[model samples]
Target: MSIEQRVTEEMKVAMRAKDKVRLIALKGIRAAFIEALKEDGSESLADDRATTILRRLAKQRRESIEAYEQGSRADLAALERAELEVIDAFLPSLADEETTRAWVEEAIASTGASSPGDMGRVMGALMSAHRGDLDGKLANRLVRELLGS
Candidate 1:
């Protein structure tokens, strides 16, 4: 099934199990999908688009966790962590290290990205090549390391 349908099903399971964190996260995800559909004037979201939205949600949770920890709010951080876990459940798995590394190398070669100045070019190529399956943050770090940045 599609990610969206899976998420809806999972939400029902979470509700039935009375898993508060998962239910909340799933609700937020559903809300996000609805908002996106309305904004884009689309009847349905592709799996890739849903994955992208989930990734963004996970990123937001990660940032919130970091900020809460920095502010000495362990309780909030823990909550964010729980939410992030739920968000991650819906995202597609990233490429393995070897696969990602190979892709990075290919992107660099294809983009002629010999220096950090070409980082954007390489990143664009990598994202297009991998679409929703690549971890963009990790790819960027790999690109920087490869380019000696």
Candidate 2:
């Protein structure tokens, strides 16, 4: 099933189970998707785009958790962490370090990126290959390391 459909099913289950955290997280996902659809003027989101929205939500929650922790707000950080877990439940798992390194190598070879100067080309190729499933930050770091940057 599509992410939205799966999310809707999960929402129903959460409501039936009286799981407040799960319910809230699902609602947040719906809201983000709606906002994206409105902004893009799309009839419905593609699978990859929906995944992108989920990743964005997850990223925001992670950043919020960090900020809350730094501000000594444990309660807020816990809430953000809970939401993040729920969000991550919908995202594709990131490739492990080994697999990521392989992609880095493939990206470098395909793009003929032998130096940091070609980081953009390598990144563009990798991002295109993996789309929403790719972790750009990690990929960039790996590519830089491989390129002796």
Candidate 3:
């Protein structure tokens, strides 16, 4: 099933099980998709767009969790962490360090990126190949390391 359909089915299951956390997370996903569709004047979101939305939501939850922890709000941090777990259920599996390194190597070679000046080209290629699978910040660090910059 498509991601949206899968999310809808999961939403139904959450409702049936009275899973409040899952239900809230699923609603947030649906709302994000709906907002993107409205913004783009599209009937449905492309898979990439859906993936991007989920990634953004997950990132937001991560940041919230960090902030809560920093502010000594364990309860809020726990809630954000729980929400992150639910949101992660829909995202693709991430690339491991080994795989990310391989992609960075290939991106550097493919783009002929020899220095930090070519970071953008290398990043564009790497993200196109592994968006959602690799964290951009980490990938950039790897690219810079590989490029000796």
Scored by CA lDDT, what does every candidate get? 0.90, 0.89, 0.89
Q: How much is the lDDT of residue 77 in candidate 1?
A: 97
What is the clash count of model 1?
A: 0
lDDT score of residue 16 within candidate 2: 100
Q: For residues 1-149, what per-residue lDDT tens digits would candidate 1 score against the true structure?
A: 98889889999999999999889989999999999999999998888789889999998999999999999999999989999988888877889878899999999998888989999999999988798878787898999999999
Winning model by TM-score: 2
TM-score of 2: 0.92
TM-score for each candidate, following the candidate numbering: 0.91, 0.92, 0.90
- Give the root-mean-square deviation of each candidate in angstroms: 1.5, 1.4, 1.6
Residue range with the least summed lDDT across 10 consecutive positions in model 2: 130-139
Write the residue-wise lDDT of candidate 2 on 1-149 in tens digits.
Answer: 88878888999999999999889999999889889889999887777889888888998999999999999999999999999999988888988878889988998998888889999999989988987666788888899899999
Query: How far off is residue 125 in model 3, in Å?
Result: 2.3
The C-alpha stretches of model 2 lying farther than 4 A from their native spots are none
Task: Report the Cα lDDT for candidate 2.
Answer: 0.89
Native RMSD of candidate 2 (Å): 1.4
